[model samples]
Target: MKKKITLTGKILLGLLLGFLFGIALKQLPSGYIKDTVLLNGVLKILGSGFTSAIKMMVVPLVFVSLICGTASMGDIKKLGRIGGKTMLFYLGTTAIAVITALFLGSILKPGAGLDMSNMVSGEVTIGESKSLVDIILNIIPSNPIQSLANGEMLQVIFFALLTGIALNLVGKNAEPIKVIFESANELCMKMVNIIMLFAPYGVFGLVSSTFATVGSDAIIVLLKYILIVLLGMIIHVTVVYGGLFKLFTKQSIKPFLNKFTRVAAVTFSTASSNASVPVSLEIMEELGVGKTTRSFTIPMGATINMDGTAIMQGVAVLFIAQIYGVDLGINDMITIILTATLASIGTAGVPGVGMIMLSMVLTSVGLPLEGIGLIMGVERIIDMFRTTVNVMGDNIATLIVSNSENDLNLDLYNSKPLKKVA
Candidate 1:
């Protein structure tokens, strides 16, 4: 009998193989083979299908998880307090993430040395920027069903929270609905396991397709930008998250990091925080968080908490401004941080969503909007890294809130040794 590899092992293998295959595709002599047969055909479908599978599960999983989590919280006042803490932690961390990116990007100056004589000149399609007033109004969701159908996360989150709160208020009368959601949440989690079975294949297709289409010129040019975003994410995830776990909670971060390895692979492959919600919830519970905490933090985190995206946008503002030789004063820098942090709440978890939000950051600073095209070639690859950080942020928030509420099961978290590290 053959020995079975662990899930993490399998995912790492897939990532490695996919990376090598992508380079191989890039090395092909003519564009025809990559364009006509492999990239355009096999790789395209596999990549699209995998993302679609993850996306298909997102709405159902979020709705059920939010309902179940909210219903489980017996104390309305405690629930409200948890909500406030969650919002503070998420917003504060996002601000910190952007600040880190701004500080680092300014020092690194990734785009400062670039020759901008050959940039593609065209108006990039940036959706209209919403005023703070507009954002507040839209949160009410005039038609929640429409929001659900369109996958509008902010509105969807608003609706889910209300439904859960209402269910809790009705006492035993809403018990049946809550029970239905609990079962549905279980079913949805099972779907996450089922979908992840294809992750290796999906990773292969996603990596190969990305590299094949991007080619060499763009990769070489944007390699520095890629490295900058990656380093910033690492710093924020490590220093901010790891530091917080050690400070307020005083718990070993080993368990949190242990569970994150698997979650990271999926988030990195799919590049969508929404798609990663089910897995994050599972790991949060496994890491000893009670139902009361995990349910609310995880879903809300996915929708509005985007530290990683904010980091990217902050770094992007500096990179573009440096490339265009635009001089931004302290006021502009502050504006960039504020705008990027706020914009992160509206950004989705999908790949390249950072760039869309980055456009807003640029416009806020009077930087050239088309500077986005300069980095588009490599955004797909960087998306994988930032998303890993984003999901990590959500899990971190859950852990923090759980510890504070004394709802964490430390023994359980310490009981099971990680597969790779005990």
Candidate 2:
């Protein structure tokens, strides 16, 4: 336990020290370090590499875990009902989140006074999709192996669902396949654990590189925009999530929040919910969410949940409107809420996902694609927070939904954390 705490503490401290070191490097004279390289370069490389390593596991982990999850479901009809409820809940919450953001953004109008005309376009590029058909088609992988290799999450999800369903139908014949997949799942988890060991180095690198490139000035320029985005996120997490938790579960929000706050903090710092999954699952189980519920909801939530993404889309659409001096009529706002909410489902669960969804939102509102560059400088910084909220929302939904379905285990949830297995 002591060793585990120390490791976790070191990871956290490294993230903080790395970020501070990065900011300090921004003040140094490049001439002094012309010959001798600085810590920034090292940190940036480590951070990016760390993120890549985490992403490296995303495809396999999601695919295998999802397959195992579906295969474990012996009843197809029950699985269908749970899936339908989950999707509807996810979609409903997402729509609510967007509406909240749209309402808040319109009311606050955070971008009104900002001068973006002089700001140069950011380096981030947005991909263009010609139609909804193309986007839908992209979800069906032509080759399963290629999809996994490419890390196409949606396609991977599609294939995993089918494979799991097939395994379920095969019954006793699928036992060997299930055992093999179970082993693969365990191996993938071990890979995640191994990658987590270097989390500090990766986090440091990512933060250092981000600050070095953007500097603090870009933050200053977009301070209001950032604040508004954050405020919107807070509202969704607190008001939306809190209310739902209380209403559905009839449990004290205090205990839930108390236990999960640490997890949320870690998610906030790490910015990869997939990376945060192990912790989130542990926390939820501690909070008394049953095994079936945790197993079913958490993985699915990780795959499709995007309340945070929805909020970002809402604010992003309004921000673009403000920057371009366009007033989005009520109809336009409604369209944005609908498009952003639906788009969140289709968006991949990876870094820079918000930007892609933002492009889709901007196009929906008739905002210039060029305006996206203005926000690009600060996108990475904000992504970390957005992802944290996304994961939190997923957990909250799982707990609430599980409680409502009478599948929750209140006693075990409030008990001590389980002993870590060797």
Candidate 3:
């Protein structure tokens, strides 16, 4: 009998092969046959199509799962407590992430020996960011249907929470509606599973296309900055999150990480926390986080829990300041952490949004905005790792909150041989 390859193994194989193939493709002559036919043709279709397929499930999964999770709670106070815990954990972790990055940046000095000439000269367009008051106001959707259609996650979340609370309040009268939502939630998970069956192929296409286009020149240029940022990510996950997992849940981090590898792979490949929500929820279930906790925390985390982005912002801020010969005091570090943590709340979980938020953070500290252009060359690759860390933070938060709420199944978490999902 042959040993079977798990989904994680298959995905890893795809990533490896895709990388080698992409490097090979990069070496080929620049012509229609190589560029138009292969890179833009088949690879584009496969990568884009797979991304679209998974994204198609995000709205429905979030809306339905959140409703089911919220309505099942039965106690509004419990729901509020859960929400509070989730927010606290998210914000705390994010602040810690930034501080860690700042510390690493200060010591390792990734920006040392680099001059302004290294800056990529391009017009960096900063997105129109909203005021704190405006951000709060925007969460209340004027039109729920429009929010869903537009994938306005914060608004969608607001509406879903209200709907779920209402359904829970109606009690016996809303039983039928609750049943429908419960059924819908299961259907959505099943759909996610079906789509994920093609994950390896999707991973291959996406990775290959990205590598073929990006090449390695940018990586070589910003090697130090990239390494320090990656180091910060590793420390946050292994030390901070790991410590929380042990202290709170009293479970080994190994199992949590084992169950989460698939989710991490999906997130890394896609580089969109929103796109990885379905996989996150599925993996959360396998990790024994109850629907009530996982559903709410995961989607909310996707939108707001950006520990990964916070890490990037902190390192980049220090890097930018160092390159410009700007001395940041303790006050500046605190501001970076606070600004990045709050900014994470409204930040969308997509590629390159980190750059936008980084711009915002830099402005807060009066760092030169041109520093963003310096790191733009390597942002795509870093975004992949940043997203993986963000998703991991979400899962860890879910576990902690679920355990506190008595919603975690320790037996299920510790169980070997995870139940096979499609």
Candidate 4:
């Protein structure tokens, strides 16, 4: 009899092969083969297609699953409590992330010995960020259909919640809609499984193309900065998340960690928190979170919970400050923590978003915005790890909220979750 490999095994295999292939391509001399053929041709198609598939599914999944989950809550107050706890947990973890990054950045001194003469002349235009009032106003969509069409995640979420509340208030009149949403949710899951079948190749294309273009030489040059950020991410995930898991459930973290390994690969490969939702929800369900909690929290977490991005920005601010030999006072550090925590909420959970938020943090502390260009070369690679941490944070928030609400199934958490084979 032949043995089947789990999704984690497949993703790891794809990641390894992609890394080797990309590294090999980098060794080749500059030509059409390296530039137009592989980079622009095959890899682009696969990576783009993979991303498109996830995005295409997000609207339907978030809309349907959330509606079903919200209506099932049976009380409007429950929704508010869940939302409150989820956001509070998200904000708390984000603060911890920034603190960890700052501590590590100070200790590692990623920018102390850095040579900036090669690219110090670079300049970047920092866009005017919206005010808090404006961000809040924008959440109420003018047209829910148009918001859904534009992929306005926050607006869609807001509208969905209102609709769900209305359905809950109306009771039996909403049963038909609830029934439809439940069926749609199942359909979305089926689509996710179908999408996973192509995940290996998609990841291979995405990772290989990214490493090939970034090149090993550039990555090696930024090794210090890379290591510092990764170390902070590791500490935040294990210590902060592990602590949260222990405090809320008093259960071992091993099972959740095991299930999340596969989803982390999705976040890393896709470099988008939105793209990781299906897998995150699946993993949470397998690890014992009820559908009501999973549906409401997972989508909301991806939209507003950006702990990993916060860590990158928090550390980047210090790194850029160090590169320019600027000294930061206690006030500057406090400003960075506040700005980064807020920025994570408004920031889009997508690839390259950390850089944009980093600009906000730097500008808040009067650091050089142009300093971003120094690390932009290797940002894509670092983003993969940062995103991995973000996905884990989302699940951790879900677990904590569920466990507290008694929405967790301890039996399922105690038993191993079944794995699907390709």
Candidate 1 per-residue lDDT, tens place, 139-223, comes to: 8888999988988878887888889899989999999888889999899889889988888888788877776667577778877
lDDT of 2 by residue, 1-422 (tens): 24356446667777678678777777776753621355534554687677777777777777777788789878898678767777887888889989988888999997797776766554656876335667688889999999899877778888988998999999999999999988998898788778777877776766666666665777888888888889988888888888887788777777777676556545655577666666666677677775555656776777678888788778877887888899999889888887777777677667777777888888887888788787787888888788888888778877886776677887765665567764
How does candidate 4 fare on TM-score? 0.95
Looking at candidate 4, the ten consecutive residues that score lowest on lDDT are 119-128
Off by over 4 Å in 2: 1-6, 31-36, 122-124, 254-266, 285-291, 417-422
Poorly placed runs, candidate 3 (over 4 Å):
418-422
Q: What lDDT score is found at residue 410 in candidate 1?
A: 88
Q: Which residue pairs in model 2 clash with each other?
A: 43-205, 47-205, 47-206, 286-413, 287-413, 288-413
List model 3 lDDT by residue over 1-422, tens digit each: 56689778998888888888888888888899888988888888877788899888888888998888899998999999999999999999999999999999999998888877855677777786665677789999999999999988899999999999999999999999999999998898898888888888888888898888874767787899999999999999889999999999888888887778888888888899988898888888887888888889999999999998998999899888888899999999888888898889887787678987888798889987777888887888899999999999998999999999999999988999845555
Off by over 4 Å in 1: 31-33, 121-123, 418-422
State the weakest 10-residue window (summed lDDT) of model 3: 123-132
TM-score of 2: 0.90
Clashing pairs in 3: none
Off by over 4 Å in 4: 120-128, 417-422
Q: Supply candidate 2's per-residue lDDT for 170.
A: 94
- Top lDDT model: 3
Is candidate 1 or 2 superior in lDDT?
A: 1
Clashes of 2: 6
TM-scores of all models? Answer: 0.95, 0.90, 0.96, 0.95
Question: Each model's C-alpha lDDT?
Answer: 0.83, 0.76, 0.88, 0.86
